[model samples]
Target: MVEFERLANEKASEYAYRYLKKNIVGLGFAPNSKICESDIAKKLGLSRTPVREALLELVKNKLVVVYPQRGSFVSKIDYDLVEESRFVRLVLEKAIIDIVCDKPDNRFLEKLEINIRNQKYYLDKENKMNLMQLDNEFHKILFEMANKLQTHELVESISGHFDRLRNLSINTIKDIKTVSDHEKIFEAIKSCDSVKAKELMEIHLSRHKFEEKILREKYSDYFD
Candidate 1:
């Protein structure tokens, strides 16, 4: 009975952490908004202890910041952190693309094409969230093909920040151009033009940096 209780608490903690992280990434929760442990516990129908434990996990991930006397709040977006993450992702992705170039597989290419088709379909429907998810899936498929599991996990763990930024970018940027850029990437990959594919991917990733600048100029209030 005690073991079962412990397992249940552990699962609850995981659930709470996932909920908080998703809400934060999806921008469903405002940055620096006060997050009450008791409120979360009540919402999840769990005890405060498990929710507290989950919050600590979020803090460790830099998704949430806890104040001693005050309550916990979502972490503010840091441009420097986003820039650093972009650099790291670029380096790792370039290496993975190089490997794929050396030994390209049809199966991997097929999967990528399928993801691209799904992305196009979502874009046509203007399903931004699904499009965003499929975009990530396309990159994840590339990394998985390269067998960079650890690097993929690290990128994915911090990808929430990037995801949120992309959400804002999609809202502000020209939709057609963004969709066309993805199409270019898919075409390059299909032709086995690794160099072009890599270049296109770099452009796609850097698009958000441009959006960040525009947001800073036009909507500074939205940022931290």
Candidate 2:
């Protein structure tokens, strides 16, 4: 079930959107599962209007599908879209790596180190969701250091399908090397090694492709 946590200052629709998107991306509402606006509205203690608006926004992001007669459903993961997202993110992140390598910041480096440490802690505890969130924060900090948060948001907007696959991977794959991968990337950045950083980023971003066959065979219902 999708859980809701109300935000004190956010509007109803904004709150609904964030809650719904998180659940969808996290696979709480599995791919292609039906979504009932009234049910969601009731669950969130909001009216249908805000929930409907939120659903419309999700539809725009390709995270939700609406059928004329059947109603709304969570969008299935689309491998092609995931590929395109990876390509776009790789290009942008490589650029970010170049910026970071040219002028590494001690402040951000420390933050990255802390993020990695926390990731390792969560990894030891086998807390996949927390590890996943930390993994995202590690990359987000890189963009923040590069002064390209807007670009990161743009990537995120188009990367919903990729995000779903990533969440699924974190949950289903036991031998996730994300922490190690982050360590390597962090070392490259800390050493101001643009060449190595870009290389590692490419390999890291492309990791999903290697898992495609296994994931598809195991969870055929999750993908389009």
Candidate 3:
């Protein structure tokens, strides 16, 4: 599969885990918000035991902080974690862009074209969440075209903290700019301009650098 799909058959615990993870990473839970297992169990129509297991997994991901008696809370965004993952992602993505630039594939270009189209459509409607998903697919598809999908998965897996930072930073970034940057990278790849593509990809990944301050100031409680 090109993307991570929900399993038609997931155990109760796995279902609870995925459901909570998406909301946490997507900013629905909010930074440092209370994570009430009983409340979540009712909402998900599952028992508290499954929700408890799900929260444990989230804790390992650093998305949830558990304190006995006090209860669990959504963790704050860690800037250092964001930079570390961004470094790994940029190094690998730049390599993939270099490879694709050298051997421009029509199939890959078409896929990106479709992604950019959807990005624009969502941006126009102010559907930021969908736009964010397209943003992820845009880069994941890059690695897929080069058969470096594992690299993308690795970057994504280690990027949970970075993803939260990005979720917060996106509020400060204009959606049109994100779409515009993707367009430039797409054009660079279409023309087989490896240098330009690499350069554009670097800028795309470093957005957190400037937006970090803006996010912290806007949502003071969300930052670590």
Candidate 4:
């Protein structure tokens, strides 16, 4: 893996957190891989203090495992946590959609459209990561328009475990399902069909059941 370099003048802990989190979530650092603080600090041209703090933050997020007098490593995919995140996301998104249905904003609709356009652009180019980023932006826009940005942030804070699965399988259900589902959700919102939009959101996010199971099996080594 290529060593990541941070921008000049940034705090080491935050930079390390972002750096390590990206690698872990993007599958650059395989699950259960040893996280040598000394090695990473050396690679990043930093000292162990900031790296240690960063790893502790990751530990609280369940993204890193630390064993006293042993070592630290990346945490494996925990299905129970994924299910919990799914529940949390479903509830918050459903509530948000219901609120949005009361009065949909044209500017928000335009934002979602632009995001979809970018999704298609990156999808056509076979850029899975970029497409997934747009997918996230679409939902972020949804919550923003619904005036529930804080709720969305709260959901995201606890979704690292589930996002690992989503990122792993983004290519599996990219265009055929994910983007199409977003389009359908948009149509429902435009028509002011709150019920339909909420149901579709449930289906869209919950549709990953089978895919997630398959990913867990295929990447057995990556799961607890």
Candidate 5:
């Protein structure tokens, strides 16, 4: 059964949307699986209306598909769309790294260090979910420091497929290289090496391509 906790001051639809999205991205609601509105509403203790609205929002994000005379289903992982999303994210991340290196704020740099430390902690615990959250927070902090939060939001808004792919990679591949990549990227940024930082960011963002075949072979049904 799916569980949800409503946040104070958050609308029912908004809360439902967030909870549903997290599960979808985490593969809790497996790709191409039917999403029963009434079932979800009952589990979440919400009315069908909010759950319906939440599904509509997910439809806009391309994380869910709706068909006439049928019902909603989790969208299959579209590798092409994932690649496109990665490309856009790479551009934005490189730009942000450039900005970060140009200024190299000590405060934010320390924050990155703490985040990486936390990532290592979570990785040791083999908690992929927390590690994934830390991974995102590391990049989010970079965007915040670079005053590119809106750009980060844009990347995230279109990164549903890529996000799902990443979640799968973290869960299945058992790769710890991501944390190393973050450490190296931090070093480049700390030393104000714009070129090195951008190069590292490109390599970091491009890792999904290398893992694509393996992931597809193992989770064939999850892909489109």
Candidate 6:
């Protein structure tokens, strides 16, 4: 019985983490909103212990912060962290592009083209959530092509924050521009033009700084 209880608690903790991440990333839980472990426990029909464990995991991910006596709250967007993540992504992606360029694998290109087709299908269906997931998958496939699985996983972990910011940016006219930018990147990669691919990626990643600035100004209330 005790072992069963332990296993249940572990599963509950994982569920809590997923719930919190989805709500936070979806902006259902606004930034700096007080998150009570007991409340979450009650809502999920679970014990407070598992909820606490889940909250601890979120804190470790820098998604939430715990106060001594007050409670836990979602963390504000950290621009520095965003910039750092962008830099790390650029370096890793550029290295991958170099590998692909040197090898010029048809298999990689075919897989990427298939991903793009899937993305278009989702877009046509107006499935925003699936589109977002597929878009991330597209990038992940690219990194996998270069055999940077670990690096891709690291990026995937923090990608939720970037996605949230990107959601806001896509609301603007710049979203259309982004499609063109992506096309250019794809063209460079497909042509095995490593230099052009790297240049396009640099431009693509740097554009996020502008988007971040716009989002901050537009949604100043959401940030600290």
Identify the leading candidate in terms of TM-score. Answer: 2
Model 5 residue 13 distance off true place after TM-score fit, in angstroms: 0.9
Candidate with better lDDT, 3 vs 4: 4
Question: Whole-model lDDT for model 4 versus the true structure?
Answer: 0.85
| Model 6 regions lying over 4 Å from their true place | 1-10, 42-45, 120-127, 172-174
Q: Model 4: number of clashes?
A: 0
lDDT against true structure, model 2? 0.92
User: For model 5, how does the per-residue alpha-carbon lDDT over 104-198 read when each residue is reduced to its tens digit?
Assistant: 88899999999999988888676588888999999999999998899888988999999999988888776647899999999999999989988
TM, every model: 0.86, 0.96, 0.91, 0.90, 0.96, 0.82
Q: Candidate 6 residues 20-106, lDDT tens each?
A: 877776666877888988888887778999889888988887889888888899887777666777878888889888987887678
Task: Report how far off residue 6 is in candidate 6 (Å).
Answer: 16
Could you tell me which 10 consecutive residues in candidate 6 have the lowest summed lDDT? 1-10
Q: Give one digit per residue, the lDDT tens place, for model 2 in 12-59.
A: 999999999999998889998999999989989999999999999999
lDDT of 3: 0.84
Q: What are the clashing pairs of model 4?
A: none
- The regions of model 5 sitting more than 4 angstroms off are none
- State each candidate's clash count: 0, 0, 0, 0, 0, 0
Clashing pairs in 3: none
* Positional deviation of residue 77's Cα in model 5 after best superposition, in angstroms: 0.4
Model 2 stretches with alpha carbons more than 4 Å out: 1-4
**Model 1, span 1-224: residue lDDT tens:** 00112334458888777777777877777677888889878877788987899889878877788888988998877776677778778888877877777777789888877887787787766547777777778888888888888789998787666776776776566653566776787677667778987898788778876576776776564466
Tell me the whole-model lDDT of each prediction, alpha carbons only. Answer: 0.75, 0.92, 0.84, 0.85, 0.90, 0.74
Look at candidate 6 and tell me the lDDT of residue 205. 73
Candidates in descending TM-score order: 2, 5, 3, 4, 1, 6
Task: Please provide, for model 4 over 121-219, each residue's C-alpha lDDT reduced to its tens digit, 9 standing for 90 to 100.
Answer: 777666588876788899999899988889888988898888888877785554457788899999999999989998999998876686876776678
TM-score of 4: 0.90
Residue 23 of model 4: what lDDT? 82
